[model samples]
Target: MTTTAAAVAPKPTGSRTAALSFAGTLRSEWIKLRSLRSTVWCYGIVIAITVLFGILIAQTASATFASGGSLTQEDQQSYALLVSTLGIGFSQLVAAVLGVLVISGEYGTGMIRSTFTAVPKRLPALFAKAIVFGVVTFVVGLVSIFATALITAPMLPKSGITPDFGDSQFLLALVGGALYLALIGILSLAIGTIVRNSAGGIAASLGLVLVLPPVLQIIVAMTQAEWAQNLAMFLPDQAGGRLYAYAAEASVTGGVIVLDSLQGGLVMLAWVAVMFVIASVLLKRRDV
Candidate 1:
């Protein structure tokens, strides 16, 4: 009798040995974002546009005044801040696209399933991505705004103008500029999470953050609605700016405003919390 050779079972091809923890997921996201070409280009553009516009506007405004025109110190300071923040509108679009890609690119490339398999708990992946995007974007915004201010300051003196960064309003505007971009970044990430489709996520984010507020402003103007105006002030963008302003003006302004800095920060935080809650629910419930 010949004995058959014993069959050997194939080694397990799939093992759960390399699961991703929250920190690991966050680190992976950071690596992915840094490795992407679009992230580099978008951030470069943001800084370039902000500085260029700040200098151009400051130079032009200074020229206009020097040509026998009049502009107050406050006006010069406010306009300088506006110039630095000019990229805010377009930068939000870049940020929204980035946010969409962070989530939707995986789906588009069929990597999302792999990601889900690695993590198993879907919400951690989403949270990790959001944290990464938010922190990176916020830091970028701060750097851009600070650099723009520094560059624009010397340029202003050439036109015989100088802004007091120590001035309450000027400081407030600077902080406001940075916070506005950060809020936009967070808002875009939320929209991206809610809408898994890249195009859909981007469109929805643009509509909600950029389009909706202006539309609401027009409506409020047409209807003369105080409530609408008040509501608009609490929007993610507005509330964030207000918080920054309040921080910058904390010592000088001192309880003069209806809503304090804490209140404004809370309002913005509430918006973020709501978006995260919705996103988490969808992430858990959806088939992704």
Candidate 2:
């Protein structure tokens, strides 16, 4: 007790690590996406809905054929794409929710603070999340649509419908489906960033994806204006639908009902770009 004071231990030096690179942020986002139970359930629902609708439509088409009704090659192809993709509109909503959750859930749970702290550069977090959601949803959608098409092929004979996946139209449909879902996912991510509340994000995303198009359609009908129809076609859903057109009719003005497939893809990209810009600005300005 009288001899010497105990030597005081030196505090360990804390190492400051550099901020996470963009790739690291993307990996983190992926990890977060896959760790959530809801992600798995939502993806499963996408596949299930796609397959179920495909089978149902194929069966119905088969019955119609069995009744001796004639279906043209074009009609058969349209039906194949339509039936397999019937769930697309609904699946977009599911994707929207998933997208919203990816960002908003972090905010709701206060995990965003940790994310921001680690990344420091806020925009990368948002970008990384967008990329993660876009890629995941796109791949999932592509696989679902492809599988649905395959399943529907057997039923096609009953409908007097034969589809070749090797065909150009079928290939376009597959690619378009993937792009459409990816766009929807990105749109939802932007809204989630803007709203920050999960419910608000989901509501706004769904409203844009579903509600707005119909409202625009009604307005266009009421107006009976050429410009209105042109404008309405640019809406995200309508523009995206243009990519899968097999039998588009002429509008009242004698112009084709469909936009060029390349143009339609560009239009969809424009929507994504606009929202992405807004989201980036908001994310930069707002506190976590």
TM agreement with the true structure for every prediction: 0.82, 0.90
lDDT of 2 by residue, 69-174 (tens): 6777778788788877887877888888998998999999999999999888798888888888899999999899889988888888866788866678767877
The positional error of residue 217 in candidate 2, measured at the CA in angstroms, is 2.3
Model 1 scores worst on lDDT over the 10 consecutive residues at: 246-255
| Residue clash pairs of candidate 1 | none
* lDDT on C-alpha atoms for all candidate structures: 0.74, 0.83
lDDT tens digits by residue: candidate 1, 1-288: 998999998879685286667889999889988988888998888788777877778778667656554567766676667666766656766776787777888877888888888788888888888888888887887788778888878777655567678878667666666666666767677777788788998888777777778987998879867677677767766666565452333221332234556667777778878988998898889887
Look at candidate 2 and tell me the lDDT of residue 196: 94
TM-score of decoy 2: 0.90
The parts of candidate 2 lying over 4 Å away from their true place are 1-13, 68-70, 247-257
- Root-mean-square deviation of every model: 4.8, 4.5
Clashes of each: 0, 0
Residue 15: error of model 1 in Å? Answer: 4.4
Candidate 2 clashing pairs?
none
Best by lDDT: 2
